[model samples]
Target: MATKTKITIQDIAEKLNITASTVSRALNNNPRISEETRKAVLKAAKQLNYQPNNIAAALRNGKSHIIGVIVPTADRTFFASVVRGIEEIANKLNYKVIICQTYDSYEKEVQTIDALLSARVDGIIASIGKNTENFSHYKKVLASGLPLVLFDRTTDQLDVSQVGINDYLASYKIVEHLIKEGCTRIAHFTSPKKISIFRERLRGYTDALQDNGIPFDENLVISSNLQLEGGRQSMEKLFEAGELPDAIFSASDYGAMGAMQVLKERGVAIPDRVALAGFSNEPFTSFTDPPLTTVDQLSLTMGNITAELFFEQFKLKDKKFVPQRTVLMPEIIIRKSSLKKG
Candidate 1:
């Protein structure tokens, strides 16, 4: 192993036959330094690949210039898009992002939050995990006077700024659409209703049926983990009972895809014998056999808005900035999967 030589501002000053203070001011582009001198210093610094010590700069500025994000899983398409949106806004503001995944575990979610706080992030944007019931950990973060914003899977119990789609209304609309397509026997595939998003969506599904003069059948609703295999197994059970629904409204695209595969194997023709609709217009939705008719949650916009909300709170502490809970309307993408009536 060879040792690498350390380069310093003094070296550049000595090489340029200029004082260290002049070199520093020029490198920083201080107004006192001439443009020509600043450009020369910048070019030299770039040629040397000089890297500033951000840690020292952060300490001096009393902020880390970094935003932390905690999500259930980074691999999911929705979360990945949200992260990209957050990164875009943060980059524009000369900030960086640190991301952590909870894997749907409440304990891991708390641990990630603690680690982010210890890292001294300027602010945090998070979507609570599936297993999260107690929000004391989040309350602790708020108590510490750090700016925090929740998105996607936020709780109404807590009075925090949030950005997400109107899950309840979106679900209601999708179910109503299925009803209008002449689907009398409709089933719902969703996770447990303990979480706010799932609860609201389930309510919407049931409400739409009741309001439209359709009897709400508990037997038609299947509670499953928001996973592909769960969807497959649940659909298999529904078939085994000899009461398969003519249509299904799934809470997630992954689950709907799984159900579609199982239904196709059993000779059930989509939009003919059975129809399917899902939430979160994931990329794979378009590539599916008939293209999924799903809800577009606008994950990227939600991420950008969440980041902007955090920054707003940080910048306008004394101006009575009201905590905003923004609920963006979801768009229903009508494709072959749910287009039953021409």
Candidate 2:
């Protein structure tokens, strides 16, 4: 490869027939500098492809102008929308965003966090992995004195800013909706219990059943990964168990889709013989055969709020780590999938 030219302020200054300090002032848009000088320096800098070293600038002011974002998987529409929201604000603030996917692995989540720390990111926004039972990786972020905010999937054990929907209440409302549809036995297809969100949903499901005089049956609940295949397997097992639930409440839209496929394969009618509801109104949910009745977690708004929370913390300049929690109420989008009554 040919040697690439390294352009500096001095080179721009030489090209403009001005001092390096004058070039720096112009490039920084210093108020003392004339507008003509600023335009000329910008034109020269752009022509030379001069990239400012944020690392060197960070040494002076301790800001890398970079933000790290971690998500379970970008394949899901909800996470992609969340990332878009984060980038919307990040781009406006002139900060670069580095995205990392954990694939719901605890080890990968830790590795991603460490890598972001090594990159000297000014702040980090993450939704913890499903398998993340221990939050030591986040504790390290707290110890390092960096701005950290968790969204969607967060833990109360961690003293940090967070933004997420009320999963428990959302699940409760979904169960009640199913009950209103005349579903006596509501089967719950859930993710792992290690995560707080999943646990809360389960609590909501059982509580809703109990409050309505319906018994919480352990056999009706199946714990699975938040995947389509997992949902299918869970539905199959529920099938093999003999008695069918009048309605199914899935923790994820993907899982609900899989269950729907299984039920259809078995000649079971949706919202007729069996109704379906799911969490996180993913894009595919709306376009499903009968469309899915699901909860809108407001993922994009959650991301925006999380980013603003980080900015708030950064502005307050409080490094002591006070927990700031923001919870959003989830809305259920009633659709044909669960509208059994009408």
Candidate 3:
């Protein structure tokens, strides 16, 4: 069996009795080419099954027309929704997106950035991994002259475009709501303070307590990875103190769910014995026993805005650009987890 010869612009040109350059211009939709010639060239190219050399074209134009999107993990609904929002805009603009997950590992985040850079992507939009402490990898992106947009998880050390909710305000609102529910001695489950989101949430929690005349107790603040297991460990540690908190506010929904499981195992009544609230409003929050109260980070909107920011920067390439930070207002979703009925 003989393999078929790969069809090319030359073959299409030969079949249509037109110049190869004309065929190329037609395929590219160059305005200079007449519509009749462009249509005929396209029809012939399709009939011949011509495959254009995209790599060579990218080399000539100095653009891959591709963008990289980095997220900690896509398994969660929040990140997945954000990616959907990004793809909606990116696809319309004729740009392909490459999704990379770091799984909250600093080393993996660094390597992912390096890989994206090597791929020659036109730009990148990312949510910094929770474990990342160094901004050098992100700075390298700027030095290389590619646009970088950070969403949800961001750092101030690097001056680049960023889009996310006002985490401090969101935290304060939720904590205040818990307070209004008559929850005193509210405990907090948080992650490392190095990351801006966690840090801001912590600050909001502390400030809310002070404003409400509740004494700030260091013992009530538990620091951990904020994963499900971490939440369980943190709750167990609180139990060791021989005093139970009237309420629990977790920086992440996963952590809150973990704490909820531990409480249920101990026969503790939710919202009656101890109210609970969480952030990011992960989809499972609604389906949990006595649905949880959480903050809506507007993941899809954040993703759309992040992609738009990247495109804005891409268009202004080579221009002196000032970094733009977009902060969206977060909604506090009230549910049975935090509402105590008489």
Candidate 4:
């Protein structure tokens, strides 16, 4: 279908019995326009469905006034909330946001960056894909002199602004909580250790076990993609060792949900025969039959800070601002899955 013609200032002016120039000036909030005329023009513009031409305005200012946001997926609550936070800040600053999902593919992440660059976005906020070992695509953003900010999943190889929770400390707290619950044999469902975030989490898990005087059993750990199916498969692999873990700490809520499904099928009662906990505090965690215990990584706040970092660069202009890394602490949410409740 063809697009409908957009209503313009002239269309609104015609409806308001005024000149197009007067309507334009009023819409732009020029001081020359009387308050009464401004109100009338705005009301008429709303009635006529007139939309401002941001592209024309951006051309005049030599800035797109649009921020490019890249994430693994919007299907997850954590990423969606981050987008929400970006939009909130973008709106307040009169900047628009365009989001791109890489779906956890390195190739697709490259494509998204190219597309955003083609669109001439003022800056970019990104959470890298799991498979992204190469950093050239991100380096290109710096080469172009565009401010780039990373969030959640980032790398040490590239020096860029980033915001995320302290995954190592968060994982340590998770394992410690399970130990306090009398769970000695604790299994872990984790992503590949190649990624810096996962590496920190895995490190925390092993350190926590060692600190608590529990032997670090590699057989009890399974690599997961942080997907629901991956969780189920990890559970099976953990049980194949001829020793069942009394508790499980999954790197993601989706993985924990998958473990729950498999356990329920095998007639295993949660927090009784086995306890469970997950990361990221996904929305569905609380809705499960037994609410899942999780660590809240402050996704929304991370996004807000990520966008603010981009604006901060604009303010500095000339002075060098060293690559900033903001790591927020994770908030542990206690629920039925991690606790033995009556």
Candidate 3 residue spans exceeding 4 A from truth: 1-53
Q: Residue 331 of model 4: what lDDT?
A: 99
Model 3 Cα lDDT, one tens digit per residue, 94-172:
9999999999999999999999888788888999998888889999999999999999999899899999899999999
Q: Any residue pairs clashing in model 1, and if so which?
A: none
RMSD for each of the candidates: 3.2, 2.5, 2.9, 3.8
Clashes of each: 0, 0, 0, 0
TM-scores of the candidates in the order shown: 0.86, 0.90, 0.88, 0.85
User: Model 1 residue 255 lDDT?
Assistant: 84
Q: lDDT value for candidate 3?
A: 0.92
Which predicted model would earn the best lDDT? 3
The C-alpha stretches of model 4 lying farther than 4 A from their native spots are 1-60
lDDT of 1 by residue, 1-342 (tens): 975466677777776778888888896678999998888788777777777665555666678889889999999999999999988888999889999999999999999888888777887899999899999999888888888899999998777899999999999999999999999889999897488899889999999999999999888888888688988977897898896789999999988998999999988999788899999999999999889989999999998998889889989754766889999999989889987886
Instruction: Please give, for residues 89-138, the per-residue lDDT of candidate 4 as tens digits.
Output: 88999989998999899899999999988777888999999988898999
Model 1 lDDT on a 0 to 1 scale: 0.88
Candidates sorted on TM-score, descending:
2, 3, 1, 4
C-alpha positional error of residue 272 in candidate 4 after TM-score superposition, expressed in Å:
1.2
* Per-residue error (Å), model 2, residue 59: 1.8
For each candidate, the alpha-carbon lDDT, in order, equals: 0.88, 0.90, 0.92, 0.88
